[model samples]
Target: MVQKTFGIYTTTDTTAEEERLYVELGQRHIALWTAEETTRQILAFELFEHEMSPLDSLAEVLKQVKLFSRLLDNRYAKTQVIWENQECLLVPNSFHDREIAPNYLDLMFGNSVNTLVQEQQRPAEQMTAVFRIPRNWKDAAQQYFPGAAFEHKYLQLYYRFSNDPKGIYTLFYRSHFILILVKGFKVQLLQTFDYQTPEDALYHILNTCNQYKMDYDTTPVHVEGLIDLNSPMYEELKKYLRDVSTAEPSGEWQIGSEFAQHPPHYFLPFFKMMS
Candidate 1:
């Protein structure tokens, strides 16, 4: 069963024509947000969680997408969809070649016949993100929101944290988490790992630090997404890292009281994309 895990609708007075829609499609979650363009205030936010069995067919996934799209207002002034998945990699612009983009993924993830390869260039960061999305999901997204822009989730993170100090930044999801190591304004590592327990998550973070020679005793670590301050993962991280904290929400956007229902850091990347 698909469940609306979290929702906050603050306004119905504004027409869809005056709002912008942002949808984040991930492995197990669908989050939608609407904002008033003029005021730049978020009007509504909804998060849905679903489980997909290995036996499920492509049609089943498309059906879930259709059901989730109902919460999206098709008449919005503009819409952008952010695709979040594990099949992506970032390459420095100097070494990036558009014609051979598929080869990069093929070498990293082996050949996949059922996916569409795409790329996004970040001129400022001097990097290009090459990613693959399942063709069925891509077709469904195109059908639901024709002409809408699409972006990989890591591109947003790179834009948000590329300028920050040298540290390890992690964003947790249901079964997987993304870890980024940045130093000297350059990304050293940007990868995702699947974990079944808090120990598994800690092992990956610490192992990455060791591999990169980052001193866990001194290097800062900022975590966000679905993790909580009191959760075992947070406590475990604090035990090993000297400086660990939850990433703060950007002060630019004016969030309403409705957003207060959840921890400010829960949707850090989602809100950062608004800017």
Candidate 2:
């Protein structure tokens, strides 16, 4: 059974015509958000958690959730779906070839016979993100949201952080976290690592810095998602790194009042996608 762990439905009326929907799908959770089209204010949001057996597919899990069904019933002006997984590669536009996009993942994560491969180009960054989604999951999303656009989560983060000053950016999930190293308007490293403890997370961050010759004493580290300022992970980071802080929201949208209950950084990436 799918459980809604966190949610905020500011308005009961779901028939608004000027609303846009954004969804993010991960292995253990699914999150949906609705925003007003004209004002770009977040209206409603929900996060659902589910445990899948080895044989269970994402499509089947989505069909079993009631909130998903109700949300899908609403008509929206636009819908954007973000897929979150570790099977993604960022290739420079100068060296990218669509004909061999699948080969990139194949070499990195091995071949998967039951996945749909797709690519998103970032013209400004001169890079392309090649990724794969489960075939059944893609079909299920298309069946319900016929015109919804799809993209990988890393691509969205790349658009937001690729040009920032030299820093280490990290976004945490339940069992895994994404680490990005950016310097001089370019991404030096982007990869996901699984962790079982705060020590594990710190090891990867420090190790990455060491491998890339980044100074832990001077370089800044910014973190968001699923981490709290008081959490052990945050403390672990601050103990060794000179400047560590939680990332703040973009401040571009009018966030609903209910969102104040949670830390601003918790949903930083989701809000950034609306921009």
Candidate 3:
């Protein structure tokens, strides 16, 4: 196995009685960070390898989350986790309180056995965001934030990129994580795929576009995260999509100037605030 880097970013002299935390949990890695409760501002962030597989890593990931929160002096704060499992769906908001409310994910992913499902309503529109969280994740989330919202990563991302004009917004992030979002007032498609080569990644992009019947030459493709102006992925994307370009996190949170140590588009630190 190869050893990769772990990171923590923060600002000192915090004074909140209880901080707020946001998490993005997945098979490859986990990200946890504290956010200002009212302003939705990011206070600190941490990233570490979780070595995820199809098998569950809830125990290990939450352990790391607690360790990082303690390091930031917010071990028992109000928390919300964004499960990046990518097994998700977005249904009509009207169905949220109906019979399908609890079974929306089961209906989509077809896992019949009882699972804890969570819902986030998109107030700006009449859409409901529904998804499955492993029972393990539901338990840990209850321990962390008993009465608050627990969500899926794509749900939060959907709200962030929901304003895009009927096209694709992709995040080629760290650890082979690709978040492909197709939005037009509502999310038409949202999937996370892992790729090993430039060809492999582009194939998925083109395939998704073709499947959706979105014109790559006309529909703008906005790229972000680990990719850059000189990357093979960027160059290849430009070859197929007419309006390919770098994208950034949408928020008013303060980013430390020292974060300049990394690429400007690398906003893993700010992602937690999307929830």
Best by lDDT: 2
Give the number of colliding residue pairs in candidate 2. Answer: 0
Candidate 2 Cα misplacement greater than 4 A, ranges? 12-15, 53-55, 67-70
Model 2, 121-230: lDDT tens per residue? 87987889999877877877787678998888888788888779899999887777989999888788888898999999999999999998999998899999888789
TM-score per candidate, in order? 0.92, 0.93, 0.79
Candidate ranking under lDDT, highest first, comes to: 2, 1, 3
Give the candidate order by descending TM-score. Answer: 2, 1, 3
In order, the Cα lDDT scores of the candidates are 0.81, 0.82, 0.63
C-alpha positional error of residue 204 in candidate 2 after TM-score superposition, expressed in Å: 1.1
TM-score-superior candidate, 2 or 3: 2
Worst 10 residues of 1 by lDDT: 53-62
**Which lDDT tens digits does candidate 1 get at residues 1-275?**
56776678784478778888888877777778888887878878877777853223434654665565545635887888898887898888999988998999999989887788889887988889999987777777787777788889888788777887799989888788989999888777888899989899999999998998988888899899898889888898888888999998667776788888788888775777774
Alpha-carbon lDDT of model 1:
0.81
Residue 105's C-alpha lDDT in candidate 2?
95
Clashing pairs in 3: 27-52
Give lDDT tens digits, candidate 3, residues 1-275. Answer: 21234464556445554567666666566666666656655566666565645446466566655664443344534666666766677776655665656565556667644456666676776777666666776676566556665666665676666666676767765546555555556577777777877777788888988888877788777776666678787788787778877666455565565466766566642463454
Q: Candidate 2 at 133: error in angstroms?
A: 1.5
Those runs of model 1 whose alpha carbons end farther than 4 Å from true positions after fitting are: 53-62, 65-70
